[model samples]
Target: MPEIAGYRVSRVVGTGGMSTVYLGTQLSLGREVAIKVMLPEALADEVSRRRFENEARTIARLEHPHIVGIHEVGRTADGLPWYAMPHLPRGHVGQRRLTGDPQRVREILRALLSALAFAHARGVIHRDVKAENVLFDEADRPLLADFGIALRRGHGTRVTMTGLAVGSTAYMAPEQARGQQVDHRADLYSVGVLAWEMLTGELPYKADDALAMAIQHAQSPLPKLPPGLRQWQSFMDRALAKSPRKRFPDATQMLAALERVPLSGGSHGARLQDFAYGAAARLQRLPKPAWVAVGLVCAAAIGLGMPWRHLAEDVADGEAAPASSASSPTDASSVSAAAMAPGNGGIADGGAATMHGAAPLSVADQAIERARERMRTGRLATPNGESALDSLLEAVRAEAGHPQLAVASTALLDALGESATGAIVAGRDAEATHLLQAAARVQEAASPSASARANHRARVDKALRARIAIASRRVNRTDALRLVEHARVAGLPDATVQQLRAQAERIPDLQGRDPGNLDGMVVLDGATRPLAAFVSPVSRAGYARFAEVTGREPALCRERISLLRVLDRRDWTTPGFEQGGGDPVVCVSWKDAEAYAQWLGQRDGYRYRLPTTAEAASLAAAGGARIVSEWRADCTANCSRRTVAGASWRTDSASRTLDPDRGYDDVGFRLVREL
Candidate 1:
């Protein structure tokens, strides 16, 4: 256990990549607090150690309900830099009880945005904003904490946040991820990601690797959520735009926009604390003397070129007495590098020339014409994601040689996506995601025009989507152990793999022991394991597995489509497929014979289902009387569900050969299960 200055360590609270938080009681004040300490291993380097100390000093100055205020900043006896703040007992937003309630999600979003807005007005930029940084009080009022890598206006580079790359790549703004000079809006982009994950109960874009996930954040389209939640699409759209110009102007605008949405759901009476958590009102309540000290720090930061954090810390320790600054904090720039686009005459890095800006409409028309001409002539017909179709359009437009960013970033993303295979295969998804995202941000930054971005987006979407599919394969094969191993190796989310396993286990199998079903069941001998199982009816769960394997649903079984799809179709309203997995499978399907047989053979250690006519008749006779007509797997590629086992769909009908390729409506299947 570690203790903050004047506090006795109590218990472990939480941990992160660089630091661990602990619960402690102040020895002198007799109050509980959160003690944050950077890991000693991370402090071995000079810069990292200093940066940790700097974070403590930075957070000590902020005074707002939504922003954590540090009461003590000190180094531990072992020399580890540490700080203590008011203990928020409810834990983090994405952890513990705040995980998925929608209204709480909204409240958290509102609180964070308000906090960020307040910070920005104070000329502070919280460079890193993520769910882990958001804490809550016992009453569930959200608070934005952790300013380890914050950038203050007029501050010199004590330790550059860009060099350290302190934040999680998944939540970084496009510009921040690209290592560009940023503004307060960068925080808003991260807030957008938080909003999406909060509302949907999962992140919008997921990949086996971090680089790929980052690429998704940079280039992928806005995540498509369920239809009912589509009303909030525009809100998320503005929040997550790759270009900052497309997003809310600031956190204040975002907070207002979010408040307008009528979305509901969270804990009862949670809204009662809305007023208590207002950052604006809290800021107004702060004594005039404190604002005067903060104002002095800001004035010195701009006029004398000092680190704002150091000056602000002076005020926190009761050492400031200067008058308030002549200028207001609103004077700080709101727009960032992401919001500003290169116009016709803009020059990019390395002295490269970019977009020869003609009229916006004129260039768009000309670009479209050139694209059509290339398609008409069939030369360089298809565009790839690396450079995509930009080269062709550029060649035809004005002989401009090439787009500036196109040359710069396309080559980079091409190499990144190509190099991420090892990580994806080795189960290092997070690393792979960051690499891919870096490239995607570059590509996003390069597109000079909306048309260019659209074209790039379309091409990149196809490429990235295909990549995600490979990263996450949906399989329901006999060798489940191998599927489990592959999924683990690919770094697929544990939840997804667990869900698949749970679904597999629910299918009822004999588990190598006789169920002793006196009604109609026979577990064939191991020597005849090829038959799969001998059963008269397939359970609902068994048929569900069948659909997963073959893709299409069993004709008369519960549908494999989503709930929305079921509601959309009028016919499904009547005689719909039963959702319960234990019920017998319904409808005639040629796939039933093969699917049912395979699952049983794999489930139990014996074969009972895939037997031919002679083998099936011998084993099936052990059970009681059953329907004579049923589908079986005894045909070739062009075979139909019409007649398997030389039988018809009608009961007691034996016209198996009469229509081997024709399917009937009355046929059904009997399947077995496994754990």
Candidate 2:
């Protein structure tokens, strides 16, 4: 190991393509540390060197219980970039003896996902998430390590070399492997690969070289787990989906699915059936020559008077298994025999093949067939992995550039749209929104025209806005809050979410302070105060309630039997025209309006005042039309004359100054509630 300042390098512990990790002791702290030094060649370019430093600085700022923290970062004596971290001597999850322990797997996945969730929340994506990067402490707790290839949100795709993505091919998301931009979901995909490796003791896809491996990741069908591990198929399917949109939206969602994974290993019969499924799948993969050779060997052994059935029974008793094999079959011979039973099409459990004279089904064909089956079973877009839409989406990816790609994608989109419609009708707007979003993602992936994409997006937005409107109208505060959360979970735009949130948040203010009068209100968003106003001018019934409760008298009117005004024998009770209780109460002066508003505010334990000229204009712009000109709090000349706003029965002018102490035949007022 190269010498480092303030530390004594002992020996090289591990090495990667870009960096070499050494076991060293910091002299000042007297603690062992893992010093990771960038390879001289990897940092030869100025762009690479700068990206390394920028990522290092970003990583150093992250502090989480399950995330490895950087101790110090600097240049080595040879001018190579390097950073030191706490040395975890217990090795990593790759070396751990898992023994198919689901509990252990759950624990490891949880810790790593927690770390990822934290880092992602801070705009960091751990582009390289593999078993080797998960280190174990003394307590066997997994800590996510090796963020050397991490990409900060919006840090630009130039952080990596021009044509290469920075992640292991076996664990890399397809999008990342294509040298395309990636987000946190890419890390979740890698985690799925790691989980597969842990449970199956092998990578899901394999090839002779890196490029071939990446192609397999991009094109191959998702691998099926061994029968005993079938409970995780749903989780695995989502985690390994070709499209990130189909996968768990984030680390937290993945963690939730992980937690829900069944802990019990199911009944023996179910396991045997699963084993038969696996055996059939394995048999289907064998070439014709291999199958013929196996048949010939069995025939010869039987013809030579070899007791093959007895030998099979002996093997079934577990006497002839390989010592190095970790998989000890419990009843394999019988299950394999059953897997090839007659009239079963050389398979079991409706497995992928039909064994017709035609060639065997390709991976994409199998995926499409599976999707059809799922659709038949009414599993279009649920249960994450086994859904019809999920199968169709993966098929689209596996058959990229194929003629049938469009067919499969169209099916997927149609299913998603139908499912979303169903969800909306069922009042599951959040689920509906998720489905619509998935449809949009599918269209985008297909590289639709800009107009097509925009049209699809507009449809989605309209649906979400309708849901927000539904939530906004919820009479109960709790129901409104729940719907708001649903809107957020549905992945509504931030602006839309804020709108729904504002409405939901005002529920308590409206219900508690203005019970039985919650309807017909408009919220003015972004105002300093949480303010709402009556949608129309306050009606005769509302004014009458205030007058009755406070025993307030009607004001002198422009045309009424009053001493100070025109004696037209009319007041608020009769505004010189026949009117209903719901109609605007005309012939009310600004002071009478003010008194009624104050009385209503006192009755409701809320502050109610006449709308300012600006507020009234906003209400009108928002479609809160008024039948009569409303009184406004705006005034001039020391409040001698108050402003009247809005259209009236007599005129459509925006505003006209009126005397505060006098009433008019065509004037009324609305109340603004301060929340």
Candidate 3:
């Protein structure tokens, strides 16, 4: 393999407008990375070189869960600026068509919005926010990349290229297409275009050339939303507004809109309003005797007037009046049933349900009360197999008459989402997956525009997504088995299904198998008398487990262990490790490594710490240069990133003390902890 700057080139992964990306492995970090080398032709131009370097520096300043991470920024001997980022195996969003489930597409868009918001908050404007820039990690998690035309506050746009439009033609905002001044809203506008493309498998506008396309975007009427995506018209309208004032104010506002989409109807393609109002219309058309009989039956089943009808009626008619004092809540029958809920948790337990001092409860309140109880008892689903999530979903979508209950519904959904998480922690992946998928299914079927429902539904959907994202990150030899079941039931992706099954067949149950392996652990004297060190260095397998268990990646490791960005030297960057099992990790400062030890110590209830000077001496005596270099917790001469003992990674390689503030790619450490 050809080696450049110590990275062994594997093969070409992709070619971008200004660079040919090579899949390479950093020799020191042992990580796979996409090295965006300035194209051989572009290298001749200083401006092109500056632009290449600018992108690297721009991305290096960002740190977000959803943004692409820049690992290293450097120049080749030929003066071409190249930077490395983690190579996501799943590829970019524009490269892959959105199929199978619309919910997943929403998630991808949500991630984009999140990334944009994060960048915008830091004064970064991703001028090019197209589908091609949104890449997916190994677990199908989205990562925003390619900030080539991005602008950070105080950094002027390229004035030299005036009148020449930048960014992708199909996704550019009208202002950007017209070479007019634009801000973060332009990025959001592009996001809208991507959303349209993902849903309908085509951009909102198309033409024979960039100039024609720009004209179309600048003046043409927006194409109709896809047949099923009519509910998204309002969002699309705001996003594609001709004027910047007409578009969403920023990424945060756009994210809220995206979250409220709820697949715009439901899983089976039915609008929540239609279902709720249809049910209400039925109640009104029925004979009074039949209505009373049916109400009585539902009351017996749920212990309340099936007040969902009133909520639907109120929502269907924006001018519906509130119940007046003279009418009394029970007598009004005009208020949403939720407005008339039994004043204190509903009277379904003993007597006729009635609202006293308070307004009647909304359908949401009843669901919150019922679902809360069921969730507490681990009754995610009923004995007859009815999902409690169904009630919770239906309730949250039906507007609550009172603001407090509306707030309560949000908290209730949080609790239900928490319960799903608890299931995962309890090692019941099947149940957690089932519950979350059930909630997602029920949630997708409804999209009520009421502020209460909109806000609460967004919150609930967030919780479900958190669990799924967590599961995706923690895919390991053991957990992969469990996650496959989740992917299948959730229908999140076929890739995850294939990934889990492939991992189960390939990776073996390795570390932590024995009670005293200590390969991935440290025990301090605080917890126990005797301490032990790892039998070997920490491995890629261990890093995977650490991230999964802690919901965090290690700090400043040379090996990019996770998909998320890491902070270093006033720069937000990432690592790129191809694979390192049994091989010692490098590029970690003593402080960060020590922090990891402390974190594990507290989390696992053990005393984990970096080896002291004496301990390191003994280890080195036994191993005889076993490591590229080892870090000692205490300083021999100076403090603050001063190394006490260890051989350096350089060819001059005599044992020497070095600054700890800086990390050498070949310098790794082992842990010592109380047993």
The prediction achieving the highest TM-score against the true structure is 3
Q: Residue 197 in model 2: shift from native, Å? A: 0.8
lDDT of 1 by residue, 1-675 (tens): 864445789888888767888988876457898888889888777767766776776687666788888866667778877788899877777774534356777778878876786677667888879878888887778889888888788874556654545567878887777667778888998998888877777778878876777778788888655534544665788788899787876665566467545474222122212111111122233464444434444455545544332234334434443444222222222211110112222122222222222122224323433333232222221334223244334433444434333432343333333333323333345654554454344444343444433443343333333334332222212223333443433334577557545544333343444433322344333323322343455544556665577675433332344686456442211224322233334443555456556665666464444444445454454442243345654554465323344343244555353243222334445533221
Question: Rank by lDDT, descending?
Answer: 2, 3, 1
lDDT of 1: 0.53
RMSD values, in order shown: 27.4, 21.8, 18.3
Candidate 3's residue-wise lDDT over 523-577, tens digit each?
A: 2222222445664555444545565676654444433334453434211123344
Each candidate: how many clashes?
Answer: 32, 0, 25
TM-score of each candidate? 0.39, 0.43, 0.49
Q: In order, what lDDT does every prediction score?
A: 0.53, 0.68, 0.59
Local accuracy of candidate 2 as per-residue lDDT tens digits, 1-675 = 687777889999988877789999987558999998988998777666766787677668777789988877767889888888899999988887675687888888889887887788668888889988899987878999877778887777876767777788989999999999898899999999998888878889989999999999899999767746757877898889999888877675566567556665566465544333333344445554444443343344444544333233223333332333323234323333324322233333344443223233345655665665465344656788888667777776777664555654565555555456445534655676577667766675653344544444444445545544544433345555555554444445688778767766654444554333445676654445556777778877778887888787787666334664444556788777766455678888888988887887777687888878666545664454456788888998888888887667688888788888877888888887876
TM-score of 3: 0.49
For residue 510, give model 3's deviation from the true position in Å. Answer: 47
TM-score (C-alpha) between model 2 and the true structure? 0.43
Against the true structure, candidate 3 has what lDDT? 0.59
C-alpha lDDT (0 to 100) for residue 226 of candidate 3: 50
